[model samples]
Target: MDLLDDDELERSAVVANCRMNRERGLLGSNGYDRELGFNPLDVLRKPSGESRPAGWLDLCCGSGKALIEAARIVHDEGMDVEIVGVDLAGLFRRVDPDQDRLRLVEASLGDWRPDRGFDLISCVHGLHYVGDKLALIARAASWLTEDGLFVASLDLHNLKIADASPLGRRIAAALRRAGLEYDRRRRLVSCRGRKAVDLPYRYLGADDRAGPNYTGQPAVDSYYADA
Candidate 1:
């Protein structure tokens, strides 16, 4: 359901929930847990010929506390890594304006594109407010280096076409064909390799009047024209 415009967002609510999301144990890389099967250090271990520093990128990063904590841990352990967090929120907490490693950006994910590739990228529960989730996923996948991970939490039922027809099954099949894995139980979509993908539908804009989503939070609904 749509309760926010593309240019306007529920930043305060999202930032507030970010703390809850972390407490609920949804922030995968928090304080580095190997049991979670996610290790940001692994991104550094992977061989890379690129000149840019190996790093992590977070979409809708909110207060960016997770990344900040990660930087502190890496610093204490003497690891070299940078973090870039992008969110539409006007201001973020726990942000050191002068901090060099963890960079926080304020902008819509739809318009914010990084100039470099990343080894690990995540969007924890950020898709709930996106108008074109599929479009973002496709672009996000392209921003990863080979073996780089692109993980995003997505709700299948939250997506629909212009006519309000549920395309959950059809979209899941499309993701598989595109080399991405959709975990139905977790409501997550992830992939390791980057490949050009073409979906069977064309974006027909979005509806910001739909209402709240399964999480009881304001969300954007995308409408794609059937191919």
Candidate 2:
């Protein structure tokens, strides 16, 4: 089976048709707070005496509606926060002219890098279409602040090796060893604080025609080789 690289994966219809997280809001049953297991606003709020501005980076932020809403709350509460949302499709909703603290960017997670560490970083069902999910996860985890939180919806079955084995248990054990937690039931991966994780696998490519998994949506299958 021929697999697609990162750039090729981006152009595939399977990745383009991913809409599981496009309309997610900030504070509802189907919202970031519920998906991430914590309120990002609470993480961004300044502590009792600290003065540094809190930062949040949301990856694959479909329309950026959640980030925009968070920006409005930050402004209304007079909180020192910076919100940055990035999406590969670049189809974000327009924000108010005065929502200066919020920035929506169009970029690929494979190459995008933030200039500053964030107190909270989230990726909602974004890795389903990514070619190198582990690499991107490692990069995102490393972008966290000393006490930051990183969370994302990840389906372990989508990660596999050359023989088509999912390697789910092995991967989960490795992730836990690296200070990351994987909730098998929820299909959520989370990490506290910054970590430089080096999973012993080399990404080969991705199969965009893998069809649907647990999410009942078309998803990509990433293949890897032992490093």
What is each predicted model's overall lDDT from 0 to 1?
0.70, 0.90
After superposition, the stretches of candidate 1 with alpha carbons farther than 4 Å from their true spots are 1-5, 8-52, 96-99
lDDT of 1 by residue, 90-197 (tens): 356575544567788888787789988888888877787677788889999999877788888788877787678998899999999999999887677988866666
**Residue-by-residue lDDT tens digits, candidate 2, 124-145:** 8898988999998899999999
Report RMSD (Å) for each prediction in the order shown: 3.9, 1.0
Cα-based TM-score, every candidate: 0.80, 0.97
Residue 204 of model 1 has an lDDT of: 65
**Candidate 1 vs. true structure, TM-score:** 0.80
Structural RMSD, model 2: 1.0
The candidate 1 region of ten consecutive residues with least summed lDDT is 18-27
